[model samples]
Target: MSAPMPTGVHYHQRSRELALTYDINGESQSFRLGAEMLRVYSPSAEVRGHSPEQAVLQTGMKYVGLKNITPVGNYALKLHFDDGHDSGLYTYAYLWEMIENRELWWDDYLHELKKANASREPLGIPLQRQ
Candidate 1:
């Protein structure tokens, strides 16, 4: 089954959120997605790596922001993050999955952090380094 088409998409820089609206079964649904969530869960090879076993744990992205959003044909979005990551192609289906499973995914991320002894703080912060 294909994902529903997004009726609208908006990025609020001040709030660091991506607002997406979709029409599902004639009902309009909206999601407010955080920039950090998008960055850490990026579908790019840089984050996902060549295989699942090689997936990179993304830390220090607490303050990451979107630099640009570009359409990839009619299927996906190319997100340019403020942290200099521009390789992710976020498909509509993937985005919808992320929205629906956000809580579970967040829990997994937190678990990964705990396993790695990593902090979500922005990179290069003096306090976070300690």
Candidate 2:
């Protein structure tokens, strides 16, 4: 079966959410994706790496937000992050997978963080003692 095509895409600035609308199997569906979630799960080579063992852990993205989104052909989107990351090509299938498995994926991410003793909080600038 072919993937559902997105009928509309809207970014809510104040809420830092992306709304994707699609029609599938004669039903209309809308997905609200959070900016932080998208940033952490970016499909860029820098983030995902070439192998599962080489996947980079995304830290300090608790408050990350999207800056822009550009379409790459008819198959995917190039997301521009506020932190200057813009290499991930988010395909329709990937977006659907994320929507469907968000809970499982989030759990795994949290587990990895716990195992690594990592914090999602952004890094703070160190103060200079005079």
Candidate 3:
């Protein structure tokens, strides 16, 4: 079984780069989010809504990056993607969870790409603007 993530993380300002403090766990991690990465990993319904089969393929996000990280509360973070996406609020625990399982998550992403028979070349979120 995987080890449980330590419950301690505080999101700081939304700067070009982000620095987080995990007090209880005595661990800290800093990550520079690329705009393309944010867009592809968006948690919005546009990227993850409807059904698994209906999941839209994301492409052309290599140039996309994170512009800012807005704190929604003590528990969540609203990422402002360079592509102008600012909807998904990654919870503190959620981010930690992702970090803890980065490899698995990355594998899943690759699997998604293969399932869709797509490439990693910057793809836009499949949702259309109304």
TM-scores, all models, native as reference: 0.91, 0.90, 0.65
RMSD of 3: 6.6
Model 2 lDDT tens row, 1-130: 5567698898887787889999877888899888888888999889999998888999888767788999889988888988899889999888888888888988898898889999788789533322
RMSD of each: 3.5, 4.6, 6.6
Candidate 1 CA-lDDT value: 0.88
Residues 48-89 of candidate 3 have per-residue lDDT tens digits of 676776557686554455566666756677887766778777
Residue range 3-69, candidate 1, lDDT tens digits: 8768898999888899999888889988988999999999988899989998999998877788899
Q: In candidate 3, which residue ranges exceed 4 Å CA deviation?
A: 1-19, 24-38, 50-54, 123-130
Give the runs in model 2 whose Cα sits over 4 Å from its true position.
125-130
Comparing 2 and 3 on lDDT, the stronger one: 2
Error of 1 at 85 (Å): 0.2
Indicate the TM-score of model 1: 0.91
Tell me how far candidate 1 lies from the true structure as C-alpha RMSD in angstroms: 3.5
The alpha-carbon lDDT assigned to residue 13 of candidate 2 equals 78
Best by lDDT: 1
Model 2 worst lDDT window (10 residues): 121-130
User: How much lDDT does each candidate structure score?
Assistant: 0.88, 0.85, 0.58
